[model samples]
Target: MCCYVGCVSETAIESIRRSTRVMLLFTELTAVLPIFFLLQERRPWAVLGLLMAGVVAIIVIRVRGTLLRLRGLWEPYSYARVYGLVAAAMGIAVLAAVTGSQTGVFTAILVGITASEFFVARPLGVASRHVGIVVALQSAAFWIVVVSTGHGDMVGPTLIGTIIMTSGLAYSVGLTYRWWEGVLKLEQARRDAAELATTRERLRLAEDLHDILGHALEVVSLKSELAVRLTDPEKSKAEMIEVQRLARNALRDVRALAHGNRRTDFGTELTGARGLLDSAGIACDFDADPTALTTSERDLFGRVLREAMTNALRHADPRSCTVSLAVTPDQATLRIVNDGVAPLQRDGEGSGLAGLARRVEASGGSFTARAVEPASFEVIASLPR
Candidate 1:
C-alpha cells in the first residue's frame, strides 16, 4: 500500500497553486477598499485616490505577468518588465508620501508590500531573504507615517500587525511552493526510471531474438543457394529438406519468444521434474504414459506439470512428491501430491496459480489445488482428449 502523502500529477498541483494566488489577490483587493471610501471625503484626497487606483491597477496587472513568468508560462525576458513595473509603483508611493498626500501614501504602502510578495515567486535563498528585508522596511515606514499623521488611532494597532503577519505568511507560502516543486521533481524522476527499465528489457529481448534466429536464417540461405547450384536431383532434394527443418525450428523459436513461454513436451517436463526434485532433496515417484495422450494433450499436460513442480518447490518444504498422469479414451488426468505443505498466506491463490487455472479452464479442463492433509498438498488437472 502507498503511504499517506498521496500521489498527484504536476499539472494538478500547478492548477491548485494558481487558484490559491488568485484568491489571495481578491482578498487583498477587498482589504484595500476602505481606503477608497475614506478618499471621497476631500477633493485632494479624492484626486490622489483616483491616481493611486490607476497605479494599483497597473501593479496588479504586472503582478499577474510576474506570476506567469515565475511559473514558466512566459519567457524569462518578461521578468525584467515586471521588475520595472514593481520599481515604478514603489517610486510613485514614495512620491505620494513626500507630497504629504496621506491617502496617496497609504495606497503606495499597500502596493509596495504586495510588490514585495511577488519576490516569493523567485528562486529561494538570497532573493527571498532580500525581499523579506524590503517588506520589513516598508512596513516600518508605513507605521511611522501613520503615527506622524495622527491617524494611528484611526487604523489601530492592527495596522503594523497586519504588515508583519503578511510578510510571514508570504514567506511560508514561498517555502511551501518550493517543497511542492521538489515533490514534482521526484515524481518525474520515478517516471524516468520506470521508462529506462522498460527500454532495457526490450533491448535484452531484441538481443535474444537476434541470437536465436540470425544463425539459422544464414544457414538456410546458404543451403538454398547451394541447392540452386546443384546438378543432382537427390542432392537438391536433401538441401531443400534441411532448409525446411531450419525454417520450422526458426519459426518455433520466434513463437516461443513472442509468447514468453517455451512449448515443452511431457517427456521433457518429467525429466526436468525429477532433476529438480532430486536437487531440492525431495524424493519423487513419477508414473506417466506420454504415448497415450495426443500431441495437444501432451502440450497442455506439459505446462500443468511445469507449474505444479514450480509451486511445490517454491511454496512447500516437501520431503516427498508423487506425480502421475493417466490417459483414458475421452480425457487425460494429471495429479501432483507433495508432503510438507505450508499454510497459504493470503485468502486466494497467487497470480501464477490463478493464471494457470484460467488457462486450463479455457481449454475445457478442470483444475484444483488444496491441502489434502494437514501436512500434504495436492494439485490435479483434467483436460478433454
Candidate 2:
C-alpha cells in the first residue's frame, strides 16, 4: 500500500521502506507481462486493463505509505484506530467502484493490501477497543462488497483471516507488557523490606550500649567514697587503686558504647556528665576543652559521662557534685566529684559499667574512680585523641 514514508517508528519505517520497493517492482512486473503477451495476441483491451491495474496498484502503495506515516505520528491508541478505520474504508470504497471492471481483480488486490497493511502496522486492539471495532467493521464491509460484486472468488476469504490473525497478535503482546510491569513492582517491594531491616538493627545496637554502661558508673562512685574515708595510708592507697581500676573499666565500657568497635571521646563526656548530675540536684561543676578530639571522640566521652551522671542521681545521695573536663593534644579527660558516700554494705552494681569499660578501652582510653576526702567520691576518664 502507498503511505507517507517520513513518520514511522524505526521498526515500522524499515518495514514500510522495504515493502515499498518490493511492491513497486511487483506492480511493474504485472504491468509489463500483459503488454508482452496479450498485445501480440491482439488483445489491446486486456493490455490496457493490465496496465491500468498496475497503475492502480502503484497508486494504492503510495497512499498506504502516506497513511503509514500518519499512523506513526499519531499517539499509539489514536494511531491504531485511525489507521484501521482508514484502511478499511479505502478497501471497501475501491472494491465497490471496480465491481464490474476488468480491473475488478486489481481492486480486490488493493483491498487485500490495505486490509493487511492495517493489521501489519497497527493490528486490531493495539490501541483500544475502538481499533478493534474499526478493523472488524472494515473487514466485514469488504467481505460484503466482495460477495455482492462476485469478486469473492478471486479475493478468497483473506479479509476475514487477516482480521482474526492481527487481533490475536495484538492481544498477546499487550498481555506480555502487563506481566513485565508486575515483575518490576515485586522487585521494588523487596528493596523496601531490606531497608527496613537495616534501620531496626541500628536502633537495637544503640539501645544496648546505653543500658550496659549506665550501670557500671554507679558502682565506681560508691567504692571511691569508701576509700576516701579510710584513715590508714596503706588502706587508703589500696582503696584508691581499686577506685582507679574501676574508673578505667568504666571508661573502657564507654568506648565500646560510642564506637561499638573502638574509639571514645573524653571532653564532651565531662560536659554531659555535669549536666546530668546537676539536673538531679547533685550540683555538678565541670570544665573541659575538646579542641584536640574529633567530633566522634568528643561524643564517645560524653556518653560515658552521661552514664556516670545517671548512676549518681539514681543511686547515691550527695550534697554537691563537681565535674571537670580537660583536653590536650594527646589526651582527653573527665572527672566527676560528688560529696557524700554510698554505703559499703552492698557490692557496687556494675550493670552499665562493664559495657562502658569494654567500649572505652577498645578505643585506647582509660577510666579511674577514687575517694578524695572524708565525704567525696570522684570518677575520671581519659582517652587518646
Candidate 3:
C-alpha cells in the first residue's frame, strides 16, 4: 500500500494496525467484566443488574466497529450513529448510579469510563479527560456504598481490581493512539522530503543550463561583433566559422546535458572564459592552482566562475576582472571580483545566485554575491577541506 513509505511493506503496516486495534478493542470489551461481582451484589436496591447488563450491551454495539473510519470499511462512513449509542450507554450508567443508593455503582462508572475512552476520546480527544473524573467517582461510589450496604468484606479485592483496570486502560489507549499518530507524521515527512529533493534537482539542472547557454551566447555575440569590424575577408570568414563552431558546440552540450551524462571540466571552462574575456577586450587576472580542489569542488567553482564572468560581460561595461582561488588547511575558497559590476547586480534579481547558494549549502559549503562600493561585485564560495 506504501502506507508508511516507498520501501516499507504493506503487510508490516497491516500487521501493526490490526494487532493494536485488536488489543485496544479486547481491553475495551472486557472493561466491565472485572467488576461483575460488584454489580451482581444485591440488585434488590432497584434492578441494578439489569441496568448493568444494558450498559454492557450498548457498549458492545457501540464498539462493534469503533474503528470503522480507520479501515474505510463503512460504505457511507459516519460517526453520528456510534456517538449517539455511546451517549445513550453513558446516560444509562449515570442513571443507574444516581438511583442505586445502597448498591455500589462502581461498575456503572466503569461503563461510562470505557465509552468515553474508546469511542469518544480516541476520535475527538475530548473524552480522555473524563478518565480520571470517572475513576474518582467510582472510588467515591465504592466507599459510600461499602460502608452502608456492607461490601466491606469485598473491599480489598474490588478496590485493587478497579485500580488495575482503570490505570491499564488509560495507559494502553493513549500509548497506541500516540504511536499511530507518530507513524502517520513520519510518513508525511518522508513524502515531503522526497518531493523537496526532486524539486531541488530540477532547480540545479536549470542553473547548469543557464550557466552553459548564457556564456556560449555571450561569446558568440562578441565573436560576431569582431567579425563585422574586420576588413580582411579571410579573417572575417575565419571569425564567422569560429562563431558557428561555438554555436554547434553549445548545442551539443545542451543535448549532452539533457541526456544526463554531461560532467563539468574545470580546465575547459577556465580556458573558454579567458578566450571570451580576451575577445571582449576585458583584461582578467586569474590566480588559481587546480591541484588543491577535489572534482566536485572544481565543478562548483567552475560554475561560480562561469556565472560571474557571464554577468560581467552581459550586464556591465568592464575593462578588468579578477578570479582568485585560495585553499587553507581546513577550507577552499573561490572569489570572482569585477570592477564594472552594475548597480542592478547588487540586489540579485535572478535565480542564478540563489541556485549557487542552494548548491553550496547542500554540499556543506557557503556562497555569497554582493556588489561592493565603487561599481564592483564579488562572488565568493567556500567549502570545508
lDDT of 3 by residue, 50-149 (tens): 6666666765654664566245342321346534543554455445544553333454444443434342324435445545555565555555555555
Task: Give per-model TM-scores.
Answer: 0.46, 0.31, 0.74
Clashing pairs for predicted structure model 1, backbone only: none
Deviating ranges (above 4 Å) for candidate 1: 1-56, 59-63, 66-123, 147-159, 172-198, 218-239, 252-385
Give per-residue CA lDDT, model 1, range 178-206, as digits (tens): 44445445555656765776885686466
Per-residue lDDT for 161-249 in model 2, tens only?
44553444334433332333333333334445556667755654664555444444554555566567778888778767766765786
Best by TM-score: 3
Ranking by lDDT: 3, 1, 2
**Model 2, global lDDT:** 0.52
Clashes of 3: 0
Q: Give the poorly placed runs of model 3, Cα more than 4 Å off.
A: 1-130, 145-149, 228-233, 255-259, 342-349
How big is the RMSD of model 3? 5.9
